[model samples]
Target: MSDVGALGDPALEDALTGLARRRTVLVASDLDGALAEFTRDPADTVPAPGAMLALRGLARLPGTSVAVVSGRDAATLAELTGVRPGDPVALVGSHGAESSVAGVTAQRLDDGQRALLDELTTTVAELIERHRGARLERKRAAVAVHTRGLSDDAEQAALEEAVGLGEGRDDVRVLRGKSVVELSVSHADKGSALLALARVVGAESVFYSGDDVTDEDAFRVLPAADGHVTVKVGDGGTAAEHRVPSVGALVVVVRRLLALRSDLAPGAR
Candidate 1:
């Protein structure tokens, strides 16, 4: 939770540089608001200029792996990022409930889980109808109520109502984010996904960046060590040890890491 201000902090820079030289490292990040700007319509979000290229550069480095961990479904995440089968970057979607590395795949919901999701989706849709500016996002294993464009009071009411809908449902898990409340049938979380990805790649260290409450799960799972760097891309309380002002600033950080890794690559002059 130490707030190392901006990427220019000498200590942070040194840590990132050192991490780049590690024998095995994993770079994972949240897609929206970390690698790409958040759009009112999630479908419209796109990566910041050169962001994907920077990630690809890191993936190319020796003993390095990269992943985009997002709330979007696996296919949608892969489509949005333009990452196809056989790409080096892995995709973890639905807050880690679903994953795609060589190809897209999703968690299979059982009959009970499907029933719960149906009920939750119906409830959220009803709530959206009652409140203007409220939107419902249906995912593979979850349904989200987004209140971004609503008035503060209206948003609070909508969120509370959504929470109430899930109060007695043991079959579902409730999660609150920046301006959205999600009811998920699957218990998967960013912490589990990050750890699993690290294990798969045999990464000795992990550098992760994210900008939402969901991102906190990933932040908490990273070991407290010089090789591990966790960064919060925007304002608000976070478990990450460093902070950058915005997604644009995060792109700069990625590019810098790519350059550092390039400089340290074997046989570099």
Candidate 2:
């Protein structure tokens, strides 16, 4: 089978093959589109088929680190992934604001941004409550307006309203996510977060996977230029080093590693 999805490109394959040989792999995957299906709320979200095994597989890899980075908070990722003993993986939640290793105390939002919560909630309530199926999500350091309602008109209007909220803050990115509009106060994105972790681990290479416009930012920056592989889940104009048809394929890649590690584990006897 010709690898036709993300990581199918020869350049990306060569990079991953090379990475497997020398670097301490850092597989930072986005939670939603990249792993789990983009859902309207946390209560309804489900982890992708191989997500748990993938984390376990990375944990077993020598000097390899895997993180489930998402817009969800730290507690949420840990709970959803069904984390067990000896898991070296990190959960970069709330868009890198709530990291299990960094601790919540380290998470910060600008004073001005923090103080705007009241206004944001009121406005968010006003904007989404009026539309059928519209949902509101208040993340740790960011706010989201989920329009999975799939109404193009509603989505367009919601984007404008989201941008309006940051009218004075040009530094803020009014990123359009898959079916949601997000407002984040922290400058750290999935990419920066990945790079920071890789640098801390003295990484020689990086393999980053994501499935949204936000993931695109991280795709632009990879550790040690040549040894990095980028995988984009689903279709988009992402500059990722590779592109996978869907999260399922992403899970397939993850499963491969998991199976590899499982075979190496001590026998059941």
Per-residue CA lDDT of model 1 for 1-269, tens digit only, reads: 54443466776687688887777888889998899998777778899999999999889888888999998888889989999998988889999888775333356899989998998898889889998888888999999988876789999999999988877778788888878899999988898888887887888889899999899998888855746889898889988878888898888888888888778744433
Off by over 4 Å in 2: 1-3, 6-12, 40-42, 84-86, 102-105, 257-269
- Give a tens-digit lDDT track for model 2, residues 38-87: 76565578888767777766766776777787877777677777754456
TM-score of 1: 0.93
RMSD of each: 2.1, 3.9
Leading candidate by TM-score: 1
lDDT at position 125, candidate 1: 90
Q: What is the lDDT of residue 214 in candidate 2?
A: 83
Off by over 4 Å in 1: 1-6, 102-106, 265-269
Clash pairs, candidate 2, are 6-243, 6-244
